[model samples]
Target: MSASVTPGEPGIFERMFPIRERGSTVRTEVLGGVATFLTMSYILVVNPAILSQAGLPFGAVVVATALAAAVATAAMGLLSTYPFALASGLGINAVVAFDIILGRQVPWEVGMACVVIEGLIAVALVLAGLREAVVRAVPTSMKLAIGVGIGLFICFVGLRDGGIVVNNPATGVGLGDLTAGPPLIALAGIFVATAMTVRGIRGSILAGIATSTVLGLVFGVLDGPDAVADWPGSDQFSTIGDALDPDNLADALTWALVPVIFALFMTDFFDTIGTAVSLGRAGKLDDAQGELPEMRRVLLVDSGAAVLGGAAGASSVTTYVESGAGVSEGARTGLASLVTAGLFLLAIPFVPLITVIGQSVPYVGDTTVVPAIAPALVMVGFLMTRLVQAIDWGDVQDAVPAFLIIAGIPLTFSIAAGIGLGVLGHVVAMTAAGRARQVHPIMWVLVPMFLAFFAEDWLSVNVF
Candidate 1:
C-alpha cells in the first residue's frame, strides 16, 4: 500500500514535500524544480564527455554516473532534510580530468579509487564534528567572499563551456567566431534563456535550452538520428574492473590515487562547508539560535555521494548552491529536491535525448542566449547586493581581504587556496593593526600551516 499523510500532521513525505507556504505557490514549486534541474542537467553531458575523454565507455560512464547522482541526491533529500542537491562538481572535474588523469597519465580506475578515498575522509570529518568547527573558523567576510568568488568562477565556467569565451593568444580572452558552429547556436540559446528569466518567467532556463536545441536542429547545427544510432550503451561493467586493474595498481596508488585523494579532500572539504554556510544564510535555514544545524548530515551526504559516485564511475560529488536560486524562489523543504531528483532519474533513459537536444540547438550568433545571460546577470545582482551589504566601504582593511579572496580563486585555480590565503591575509592584517586579540586563537595554528604548505610547494618547484 502507498504511504498516507495524516490530516494536519504531515508525514515524513508530506513534511519533505510540503505544500506552498507564504510567497510560494504550487506554481512556484514547479518553476523552482525546473530551474534546479536545468542548471544541473549539464552533468548529464559533461560527466560523460570527461569520462569518455579519460577512455571510459561513454554510455556506461553516463548511465552509472547519472544513477549514482540520482541515488546520492535522493539520499540528501530523504536523509539530510535540506533542499541542497548533489552532482559531479564543476572545478573538480577539470582538476580530475586535466590535472590528475591527463596531466599525470594515471589510469582512470585509480582516479575513481582516489575519489572513493576522499569521500571516506569527508565522511569521517563530518562524523567527527570537525565540519562545523572548520566552518566557524572562517571569517564572515572571507565566507561571503568565497560565495561570490565561487559564483564568479561558476559563471566563467558556464561561459567557457557554452563557448561564449574563446581564447585568443593575440588579444587574450575574446568571443569565438559566431560562424564557428554549435557555439553560435548555444550562444543564441543563452540570450533567450536570460530574457525569459529576467522577466521572472517560469522555466526560463528550460525554455532557453529547448529553444537553442530546436534552433540547432533546424539549422543542422546538431545531429539527428545518426548521433543516437552511434550513441554508446551501458554494457561495459568490466570497465569498472579495468579502472581498478591490478596491473596498473602501483601507478594508481602513488600518483593518481594519493594526489587526487588529497586534492578532492581539501577542495571539496572547503567548498561544501563554505557553500553550506552561505546557502544556509541565504535560505534562512539556520536554527532557533541562528546557527546552522544538521550540517553534519549535509557534509556526510555530500561525502557519501562522492564515494558512491566514484564506485559508479564519476568524479567528485559536491552540493550545488545554484539550487539556492530555487530556494530563493521559495523551496522550503526537501520536496523540491525530490522532485528534481525524479526528473534526473527519468532522464537516464533519454541519453539520446540529451545528445539530440545538444545537437538541435542553433548557435546564438552575436546575440547572447538566455542561459548564458542569466549567470552574468545573476553575478551583477550579487555584486550589487554585496556592495550595499558592505560593513565598511571606506576601510581598506576590510576591503583588502575581501579583494584577495575574490581574486585568488581563478588566479590560483584553486578555491581552497584562495580561501586559505584570504584567511591568512585577514589574520595578518588584524595582528599588524594590534587587533590580534580580536582574532581567534586557532587562526595562529591554521595560518602558519597554510603559509608553510605554500612555501613547501614553492620550494619544491623552484629548488627541486
Candidate 2:
C-alpha cells in the first residue's frame, strides 16, 4: 500500500512525475520498472528472430524493437500519466511474418504499410469514439475465439519453426524427427521455461532462452555472429522506413490483403484495449462508467506507437499486460514506464548479444528452421490460452463460432481468414437458432465484406 504525501510540497522530480501524489517513491517506481523490464526483455531476442524470417535484418530489428518499445512506453507514461508500458505485440508479429509476408507472399514493406493503415484507422476510431462501438459490435463469442485461434496459430508457428512438426503430403501436418537436435533443443527450452514458471522464478522466459542458447552451443548447433559485440554497422533500421514508400504499398496491396489489414488492426485493437482495461481495473483506475482516466491520450499514444513501430520495421506496438507486474510492485504512475524506457535504451550496447539466436538451421529435406525462438512462441501461446476457459462452452451458438476461430486459424494459416470464418459461423448459427435479430448489425455488414474477401482470390483466379 502507498502512503499519502502532502499535495503542494514537491520534492526533486516530484513536481514533474507527481510520484508522491500517486503514492509511489522514486526508488519504488525504479524497482517496479526494473521488474517490468525483466518480464518483457525476452522480446528483445524473440521478435527480431521471428521478423527476420520475413526477410528482415535481425540486428537492425533488435534496435528498432527496443527503440520503438522504449519510445512508445515512455509516451504512454507521459501522455496518460499511467504506468502502462507499450511494446511490439507477439501474436500480431506472427501474423505479419507468417500469414502476410511469408504465407501470403506479400512484401514485408507492404505488410508494414498495412500496419500504418491500421494505426491511421485506429487514430480515426479513437478521435471519433468509435473504438468502443466496434468493440461492442464484435460478439463476445468471436472476441473470445480470436484469442484462442491466435494462440493455436502461434503454437503451430513454433512447432514448424523448430521443425518439431512437418508438412505431411499424405495428410496435413506431421510430427518431425524427435531425434533431431533442433527440435530437442526447442523442447528442452520449453521445459526449462515451464519449470522456472512452476518454481516462481522471475524472468523465467528469458532464463529459458539463455539456457537453450547455451545448450545449443554445447551441442554444436548454435553459432555466434562473426563479431560477438560491436558498434552498429547496418541499414536494418531503414527496413521499415523503406516499406513506407507509396510504391511499396501499391505493390503489396491486392484484393487478398484487404482482410489482412483488418485482421492486423483487429488484433492490435483488442490487445491494447484488453491490456489497458484489465490492467486499469486491477490498478483501480476505472471510473463509474468503467472507462480509464485520460483514455483519449492513452488511445492516441497507443495508435501513434503502432505507426511508429511500423515505420521502425517492427510489429504493431500495444500496451503490455506485463505492466501489471510493475503495478503490483508499487508503480503508481508513469515514472515506472520512464524507468523502463531508459533500460531499453541502455540495452543498445548488447544488440549483437541478442542476435545470437536469430539464426536458423537447415535440415531434413532442406527445411529452414528457427529452433531457438520456438520455445518463446510456444510459451506465448500458453499464456494466450488462459482466456479460453472464460468462454461459454455449453451454448452451441457461441461454441460454433468459437470453434471455427480456434480450428480455422492454424488450419488455414491465416488470421484474417479465421476471423472471417468465425464471423460467418456466428451469424449463420444465430440465424439457424432463430436469434438472427440479436446479432449486431455491423456483423451483417461484415457478411458481405467477408464473402468478398474470401471470393476475391477465387474470382481472380477463375474469372476475368
Candidate 3:
C-alpha cells in the first residue's frame, strides 16, 4: 500500500519542511497554525461584509475569501517555506469597495480586474528584480504613514457601519445614537475585544465578533440564518472568474486609471515587505541584516496571491501581521502555514455561519446596514496606529507627509487619495526644507502622475 523507507530516513513531512532543523516539531507547528488561524479568522466575516458593500455576493465572497486564502497561503508555505499566511487584505478591500467601485462608478468586475492588473504588474516587478528598487524608493516615514492612514480609514468605516457615526448635513459627520441597538452592541463588543487584547488573549477580534452577534440576536436586531448548514456548489461562487473576463479587463486597462493601479500596487508592495520583515524578526528567522531569507520567494508568492485573489473575486491578498501570533507560538517553518491553509479549506462548509455573523442589520433607515464586525475593524485600526511611534515626528519634513496621510485617509474616504496626498506632501516638504536631494527620483515621477490622478475627470473633459 505504501513505499518502504529506510529506518533512519526522514519522512515526507520532515523532508518537505525540515521541522526538526527549525527547532520545532509537528505538534508545535500545528498548534501555532491553529493559533494563527483563530486570531485572523475574523476576516471570514469582515472581508465579506466589506466586499458585499461593493455589490459582491456575501456568500460568494465568503467562499472566495476562504479559498483564495487557502491557495495563497499554501503556495507561500510550499514555495517560500515561511510560516506566513495570506488573506484578503483590509485596506485594499476598502479600495475595491469605496474607491474603484463606488467612487469611480465602475462595476465590481472592473474593480476586480484592476486588482488583477496590479497583481500581474507586481509579479513582473518581482521577476525583474525591481521590487527592492521600488521598496527603497518610498520614504520609511511615508510607508509607516500609509498603514496608519489606512487604520484610521478602516476605523472610520467601522464606526459608520456599526452606526456609531452618522452623516451630518451641517458638520459633514456626527456621532450616532449609542442608545440604539447596533451602536450599543458595537460598543459592548469594542469593550470586550479591547479588554481581551489588553489581556493578551488570542483570537480577540473573533471573540468580539461573536459577542456582538450574540447581542444583536438578543436584541432582535439581526435575523437568524434560515439554514444551519449547506453544501457549497458552483452557483454559490457568483463572482469567481469575473476579473478575467475580457470586457472587464479592457475596462480596467486604461491610461486614466494608471494612478489607481499604481496606488493599489504601492499598498500591496509595502505591506508585504513590512509584514514579512516584522514576522521574520519576531520569529528570529531573519539574518544579520534583519532581512528574511529567501525573501524573493516570499514576495513572489504574495504577488501571485493578488492575482489569485482577484481572479477569485476576492481583493488583493497579502501577508498578514497576525502571523506573528503563530510565531509567538513557535511556528518557524512552512508546516504551520500548511496547517493554516488546511483550516481555511475546512471552513468552507460553514459558509452559513459566516453569513449569519456578517449579515447586515438595517438600523436607522434603508441606507444603514450595521455590521457586528465593526469592533474588530476598530481594534485593527488601533493596532495599526502603533506604527505612528516609529515615524520621525520631530522632523518637520517627515512629520508633514505622515500627518497628511493620517488626516487625509479618513477625511477623503479614499486610501489611494490619501497615499497620493502623502507622496505629494513628502516632495513639497523635502523641497521646502532644502532636502530635495533626499527625495527618490521615482517620487518625482509619481508627483505629476498623482496630480493627473486627482484631476482625471477635469482632464477628461477639457484636455484628454
Best by TM-score: 3
The models' CA-based lDDT, in order, is 0.63, 0.84, 0.89
lDDT tens readout by residue for model 3, 1-464:
89887786876777899688889877898999998999888888899999998889989999999999999999998999889999999989988899899988899999999999999999999999998789889888988998899889999989988999998889999988888888988888888999999998777888888889999888887888877778888877988899999999999987667777887898899999989999999988999988899999999999999999999999999999999999999998898999999999999889988888888877766666655989889999898888899999898888999899889878999877888899999999989989899899999999998898889989999997
Q: Ten consecutive residues with minimal summed lDDT in candidate 3?
A: 362-371
The order by descending TM-score is: 3, 2, 1
**How well is each residue in 196-232 modelled by candidate 2, as lDDT tens digits?**
8888776767776877787788898788767666666
Clashes of each: 29, 0, 0
- Flag the better candidate by TM-score, 2 or 3: 3
Off by over 4 Å in 2: 1-9, 251-253, 288-290, 462-464
lDDT by residue (147-180, candidate 1, tens digit) is: 5555455555456545667556797678855665
Clashing pairs in 2: none
